[model samples]
Target: MSFYKKDNSDYLEQAFYSLQGQTLPADEIILIQDGQVGADLENIVKKWSQRLPIRLFVNRENIGLGMSLKKGLELCSYEFVARMDSDDICHPERFEHQYNFLKSHPEIAVVGSWIAEFSETIEKISNYRKLPSDSEELFFFAKKRCPLNHPTVMYRKSDINKVGSYFNFRFQQDYHLWGRLLNSGFRIANIPKSLVYMRVDERLFNRRGGIRYFQIETQVQKTFLDIGFINKLEFIRNYIIRGCIRLIPNSLRKNFYETFLR
Candidate 1:
């Protein structure tokens, strides 16, 4: 699944190229237009539709990522759905590796992989986002941070729907959905190796701070608490630590992620 909101001609093209390069190609690509987009983006999609089985869905109004993804999930024809970002590049063997894992581990409902984050180019990888590989470790990790890389995940459609699907949250949609899945007794795991290259720049770091983001973080934490995924003490501790992390400089924030969260 992929979603786009504006004119991202260059990045979108690279994303599609990565998909086309995959050794185990996708059966169908579900592209969601979250809102009004440029003609250039439409043309790019049209150009790729000729080569791949691309199913496009347009949302007249901007409904945000959660609702947009929920719409995409409803249109998926396969049992397994792989999530992809409009700006990231997946490894050539990403699908093959993930598909084999899920097929062998029938009990696992979701599988994700580590990602190498870069600034301008894939060769200049800045850092890696490493995650736990087992459900027990993932459940413990989820109380404090997101246990899975959202864009690198391949999940069972039936399991996600059984756990109430994606919710319409501003900044924490993936995080919230993972919590719900864990509570519903679905197992989650991650591959130790990197399966995708994630794009990160100044804008990505800058988005982590500010009062508005804090409010959204607090709201998400409350939801987790109410759902019994987190207790009162854990919620308060998370809020304080995360609020402090947000208040720091972007450089320090990046370091915090690498030093503590990763």
Candidate 2:
């Protein structure tokens, strides 16, 4: 099950191609279209549906992403759920690799992978690769930002339900949801492989990007506070240290972030 928007037709094609190339293709692909925005996703789905079963949940009203994801989870008929974004390319072996890994390590509630982030101008500016392995390390990595890439996550359906599913109307729902899951004693793991190509929208380089990131960070910190994971001082320390890099000049930040951190 996946939530997608329009205006990302080409990326959607790449996504479908990846899914089709998977060793174990999805039995049913449920796409949650937020609303009909003059983007003919239905037509594309129709063309692809002949080869694979595609079920689209079109919302008459424009529901937020968090709600759409929750709705998809509720409606999914599978035991496991793999997440994909409308504008990302998944690796051909993503499903097979994650599925096998999860089967071998049943203790993990969620599994994610590294991703390569490309600019719309076709330059690979940054990468978001995860650490080698260690659930605890992954947990620590998530303190400042989302350690797990959303598009590369595959999780147990029951585990999500155990945590009460996705938070309603949360802007940084993924981050907040991860905090809740960890607090509830769920473990997260990452495969040391790049399984997705993430595309950075050009607009995200502007003021709006800063605002969105700030909102996500605020919500993330609030979750940690509410769960008693960190005190005020600790939260402040993490906030400053983690976001300090973004304060530097963009060129330097981009180089450092991509070369070292990733």
TM-scores of the candidates are 0.96, 0.86
Model 1 steric clash pairs? none
Cα lDDT, model 2, residue 222: 71
Error of 2 at 121 (Å): 10
Off by over 4 Å in 1: none
lDDT, candidate 2, 1-262, per-residue tens: 4444545666677678778888878888888888775446666677777877778788888777888899888988998889988777777889999999999999999999988777652245455666546799877777756667777899999999888888753456787778788878899988988888777643443322354566566667877887876679879886775466545555665555558766
TM-score leader: 1
94-118 in candidate 1: lDDT tens per residue? Answer: 9999999999999999999999999
TM-score of 1: 0.96
Candidate 2 has which clashing residue pairs, if any? Answer: none
TM-score for predicted model 2 compared with the true structure: 0.86
The global C-alpha lDDT for each of the candidates, from Candidate 1 onward, is: 0.89, 0.75
